[model samples]
Target: MGKAASALDYRELARRRLPHFLFEYVDGGSYGEVTLRRNIADLEAVALRQRVLNNVSEIDLSTELFGQRIRLPVGLGPIGLAGLTARRGEVQAARAAEAAGVPFCLSTVSACPLAEVAAGVTKPFWFQLYMIRDRVFMRDLMQTARGLDCSALIFTVDMPVPGSRYRDQRSGLAGAPGVLGDMRRVWQALKRPSWAWDVGIHGRPHQLGNAVPVLGNDSGLNDYFAWMSSNFDPTVTWKDLDFIRSEWNGPLIIKGILDPEDAHDAARLGADGIIVSNHGGRQLDGVQSTAVALGPIAEAVGDQLTVMADGGVRSGLDVVRLLALGAKTVLLGRAWAYALGSDGQRGVAHLLQLIEAEMRVAMALTGTTRIADLDRSKLVSAEAGANNRAAALA
Candidate 1:
């Protein structure tokens, strides 16, 4: 791939490089995709105020999260099947994140195992967990994370059951059963010869690495998906968090919070942070966007816990918009995944550089010299600014 000027450029490259099934898996959302569209639209509708004649020399983009100093107020969010995007893709992304002085979060269903990724990178990365039905496996996973020296444990609370993503079903990507659908999937993979060679041919051990012990030997991709479909604990509730808290002694963050009540619950549970997200619009189709939900949640619990957000964040200016609304930092899900799918590690590095450069220009234009300086004052829309102020007052 040639040089990518923006995240969309890398997304286009990813579209060309990956097969239809794989691309749809990363790009599509659940049901009518109402929440998916709203996530981007609401973020774009947020206007930024412009200020002139302000000195912006020596801008410091570094910030502290969970007591670790990072290069930027952004981190690569957890992504499943990332290794299928390239050869050992999670390790490559983690290395790139470390090189860029940022954090890379590993998924519970990662194609690459945590031990391998931990061995490949210099710094400790974060781990995202999906509560499963088996307490033995869940506890073992936490022990494995602690053994790997994971910095934080992000407990995902939204997906009690997988959402209905019709695009995946239509594309034969979500294990649609039928000989014709199977043939179509095979044909699609055959068309992407380069991807097949790199990920299919050369990329051995296509099994879900972290789930190997429970799944036993000779488990394939289909078996992994089958396990996931049957294993997610639907009986989970707020009280179950005590089990996780007892097992993990590190900084804990509750992901998938989009309501003030949920945010307050996280804070009351002694969580160190709360991530305002809608699973990147992959869960609950008609729900509100993270951009719309973030302000109120932050206002309700910002004083008690750290607030972060992720959903339809495509650029550095979007990062600024999120911070102006109340997030201390933001996470990128599809942004870095697209880069990795397009050009592997180099693509992720370039994307990070592009976002950082964009953020610097945005901060200078908005008359802010530090990440801490961003607030409702920098918002161009009076209503948007007022919403945040009301959140604070409430």
Candidate 2:
């Protein structure tokens, strides 16, 4: 088989495979997408100080999160309606993650059932949770994940309400009509002949796997949406964290922490780890990029819990940037989705290979032998100075 190239290769391929509506849902950001643009720009600004004539042997990218060992320090982040991107997108993505020796996190809103994905991958993976008001429903969801042998539970604290993705509105995929565009997304779907043939004709177009039992098939997509809007336990408090901790009995990671204080709070609340993320600029607009906040958050509570960050992570070099800032792992949200959209399982696997190759090449260039050897000293940008401040704050 021919070798795959870059993340952009996968992205462009996905653009070709998925319909315009589905692509926008995964690719677009909220409001003006200022945060989205910044996430990529800020990450790019941190340049790696390459060194020469150093012993670069055995570029080990393996990392241990909670208790599970992964091949790399990057894992696929949760994406809602991932299946809509491709035929059974979550399963395909999970299979790719398994092939790469990293964890694939399934969203609470994914189309494939949790157990089915687990059965597809033939290994333990991480499950992302969106706490709901219904105790019985939440318990069942947790039980399903547990039965599937998921190693950890990532409780997403963000996404209490969906963000206003103007691109999705423009793509004709969104629920509401916006001043920016019209809702005739069906025409765009007609244009994507591949999707209408593969995704639209072959299987279920869009369905929330977790909500199937609750709303039942008669409920349909509209009912699923209504149930989720009403069901998610948005009034979630720290005390609720304790409740989740009691239930899962696994590594409980609290995602969506932007502030150092909250990172510390996640540690105090019995969280096994905390992901410093801004929901990929999909939630609040004009927020500080996760990369900008990572170093500080890592410094504040790095010793207490695992420090991971996600937002605008496009390449392996960005992985190094995050590691320098104190992130043990970097979550790939759009990158994985981009892969899924492009060529389904093959596309995702190719993207993972590219990232790993990029990271190994980067390690050789930086004259570093191991991931732990990387630190602030390698980065000359002002962000490194900010990371230092985050450490001081802690």
Candidate 3:
């Protein structure tokens, strides 16, 4: 692809490189994608307060999360089947994240197994867990994560059942099963010869790595999806946190928290942190955008638990916006995924450089050199904007 200066540029490159099904899987959201659109729109609307006279010489973006001193307040959040983005994609992304001095969270539905990821990177990454019905399997998975020296456990709790994503159906990722479905995806793959040669041909045994033990070694994507559909425990409640805590002694982060009440509940349940997300607008169609939901949720549990957020974060400017709104750290989803698909480990490294550079400009212009100095003070107040509008109208 051409020069990729921003996450959006990488997204375009990814679209050109990947097939229809793969690109749509990474890009599209659930139902009509109302919440998905809202995520980007609301984040873009966040106004930063720019100031001049403060002598901003050096800027530092370093921060600590779950006891790890990361170079930036950004982490590569878990994305399933990320291995499909490139050859051993999750491993590539993890290596890039390590080089960037950021945490990488591996999904339960990942294409690369936990052991493989551990083998690929010297530093331990975080792992995301879904509420599965099988307790035996759950405990085993937790044990496996611990054995791999994972630094933290992120338990995602928003998806009781999978949301209705129309794009997946249209792209033959879901609804169409068996040989017909396989053929449909293969046809799309054939069109993207670059991806086919790289991920399809070279990247052999494209199966969900973690699920292999349960779903059997011969299972395909459809089988994995089908198994996940039946296995996800809809009856999951706060009591499930007890089970998680019992199995894990590391920093426990509850992902998919969007409501203040739920954030309070997570704090009460003794979660180390909470990721204020709506599952990237993949689970619900009309929920509040994370940008709109983050402030109140952070207010509710910021002291009791670390407040992190993810959704519609495409640029370092967007990262600054969320931090100003109250997020201590921001996890990137599609930004790194697109970069991975566009090139691979090198692409993700470039993306992090772009983010860090953009953040420097933002921090310097906002008269803040430290991440700790970023707060609501660096943001344009809604009340002030409204009053300015009113005075102009009068």
Alpha-carbon lDDT, every model: 0.91, 0.82, 0.94
Candidate 1 global CA lDDT score: 0.91
Who wins the lDDT comparison?
A: 3
Model 1, span 199-306: residue lDDT tens:
878876877889999997676656766887899989999999999999999999999999998898899989999999999889899999988999888889989999
List model 2 lDDT by residue over 271-342, tens digit each.
Answer: 889999989998899999987888888888999999888999888988888898889998998888887777
The list of candidate 2 runs beyond 4 A from truth reads 1-4, 176-185, 218-221, 381-394
What TM value does model 2 have? 0.92
- The number of the candidate with the highest TM-score is 3
List the pairs of residues colliding in candidate 2.
14-341, 14-342, 132-233, 296-390
Instruction: Report how far residue 172 has shifted in candidate 3, in Å.
Output: 1.0
Query: Candidates sorted by lDDT, descending order?
Result: 3, 1, 2
Candidates in order: C-alpha RMSD to true structure: 3.9, 4.7, 0.8
Error of 1 at 34 (Å): 0.8
Predicted structure 3: lDDT: 0.94
lDDT of candidate 2 vs native?
Answer: 0.82
Total colliding residue pairs, candidate 2: 4
